[model samples]
Target: MPHMFTISPDFPPNSLAGWYIFNTWFQKNTGLNIHLNLYNSFEEQTIAIDNNKNDIVYVNPVDAVRLVRDKGFLPIARVKNRLDEVVIAVSEENPISMMCGLKPDLKLAMTANPDVNMISMMLLEAVDLNNSNVVKTTYDSYIIVVKNILKGEADAGLFLAKAYDDLSNVVKKQLKILLRSDVEELYHSLLIGPELADRQDEIQTLLVSMTDNPVGKGVLEALDFEGWLKIENEEMEFMIDLIDTLVPDTD
Candidate 1:
């Protein structure tokens, strides 16, 4: 049977097709029959994960930790230098200069990315803020999150740093970044299940050495990656440990 390769639904919409292209490249290069599966919703994906055996995944930090710890997946690589930082922002007119200025009942706009939300919540810890103390309004994307803040429906916005960077200069100037988390180590990763255990080294080498060839360079351009880099087990463990320390499991 062909190996199942899945990507997190949180990837930017523009990059959706890029993953398919990369899958074709991967199959061509690796001479392996890999099937790509992109889920429409996390809930639907969760159901599939519970009943299925996924061979490979490119996922966000939150899921990365989950798969490594619970599903016994092996971290192989991450997009080059792609740390998953969170950006907390407020409207230009709002007077909250620092996170300390935050208080109970402050309205927050955010997307459904749990990793970004978790880190944003950690930033709110500066003022001892938690979901109970703040009001959260979920948006379909970062753009809408900013829209809510600009329109005064939300007092603040939480964003993935790359999404914030992609916003137009005009829109960005109308808001202020109260803070951008700089944990530096949290990032998404490509992982493989035990089914691919024997081929781990082979797959890792192909990913990390993508920049060495023209075909590989073309695929990287489509995916908007500088290149790929190996995810050392030790580094991944520290990130998992940090996540465990930052966010404890609750029933």
Candidate 2:
């Protein structure tokens, strides 16, 4: 019998497809059984982890910070979210000449849930939230924010790399990049949970040693994962400092 490891997957295409491919590869190469549990939202996944529901999970940067503090989970690898450009979008016609000059009256659309929008808020505070008059537009998902902007409900919107990629030709053409943050060297999608921590060496071996075999290579190709990197507590501490400066009261 093989030790079965469970992963909390977020959504379809990227989440399910990527997990299935990686799970197939991991089992064949390492002889450890792999399973994935799909969730409708990151909220569900985060709760599951807190309740000891799964062995591992794929978390976003914002959630990764929370896991580091609350769950004491170790990061084995980061899913490279290729699109690095964080866009400051305004109405296509607006003449916002500079990043600093963008008005305080700019109504911003952001997700109400912390799991999805906390990182963006952290990024904004790092830039200068005190000076800006940002009206928070709440929604269930980030896609709703894009629609609010197109309909003239918002003056500007914050979006990740993939949001721009998935935009329609018209919407793509309509939006202007008001500003983009400096490139982040590494944005981690950490693997969390107590089970993974106890079996750290085994987990690391399974991820890093994958490329040695044919089956393992297939999963790596699907996930676009180069390999695993052993992240230290000090690195996670840097994120702690950043979060502290942004949301001091609660991590």
Candidate 3:
């Protein structure tokens, strides 16, 4: 048996069933025994990658930029499945400008994913976090956050695109969208590791051709990915801009 490489999945332990299917698929396809270090939170996943507890990790674009710049890592490819979205919503009766008018006193809820940092930065840019009324509450899952807003526990909520689609009926009836993020054009969710930078060609080939193999095909489908593509340097440059434009001056 060769060295067993590890991947920190984007999804929690077996939460999507397909994640494990893809894990097995990639392991068999690459001839590298693969294992998953399950994570319940994005913070945990980011820390695991930062500490070298996982290899060839999957991360959202925000975290991806952080890993590459802060850790001198490289991305082999981005996930073909791009489900991340940022939603800014308010209750129907409340005017959209109410939060800004209130200044640091308005209540907001957001998904607890570290990648959500990008969304938060956008909102802060629109309104000063210090000058405006902004109180934040976090939930482990986006669905819970949606529920909180629906039940009047929260004044507004930010959620992923899939969650927004799932809650379409309720959103239309009771909530209003204040803002939506820009579409990710070259947004490959990113497959990366510091150690694999030199093997970019091989990794990209394996991922793109995996579909031709039965096991590889299964993993691709499980991950909700069509296939991986070679990332251009320009794509990475775009990510850099997104980060610079988004990251706060807390440094």
Best by TM-score: 1
Per-residue lDDT of 1-251 in model 1, one digit per residue for the tens?
Answer: 99888887667778887898999999998898999987875555666766665778987887788888888889899998788898999998888888889899989999877788888987887798987889998877788888899999999999888878778899999999889889887888999997777878898999999999998998999899999999888988998988888774641
Q: Once superposed on the true structure, which residue ranges of model 3 sit more than 4 Å away at CA?
A: 1-15, 81-83, 91-104, 120-132, 166-176, 183-188, 211-215
Which pairs of residues clash in candidate 2, taking residues 3 or more apart in a chain or in different chains? none
| Candidate 1 C-alpha error for residue 1, in Å | 4.4
Ranking by lDDT: 1, 3, 2
The TM-score-based order of candidates, best leading, equals 1, 3, 2
lDDT of 3 by residue, 1-251 (tens): 23323343334333367766766766665666667656766666666776766656666667667767877667677666654666677777766644354345657777665545456546655667531346778777666676777787887777665456556475557777776666554253555566666766777787778778777776776666687766666777787787677666662
Better of 1 and 2 by lDDT: 1
* Residue lDDT tens for model 2, 161-215: 4545556677778777766655564364546465557666666766766677776
Q: What C-alpha lDDT does candidate 1 achieve relative to the native structure?
A: 0.85
Judged by lDDT against the true structure, how good is candidate 2? 0.60
In order, what lDDT does every prediction score?
0.85, 0.60, 0.63
Deviation in Å, model 2, residue 31 alpha carbon = 4.7
Worst 10 residues of 3 by lDDT: 1-10
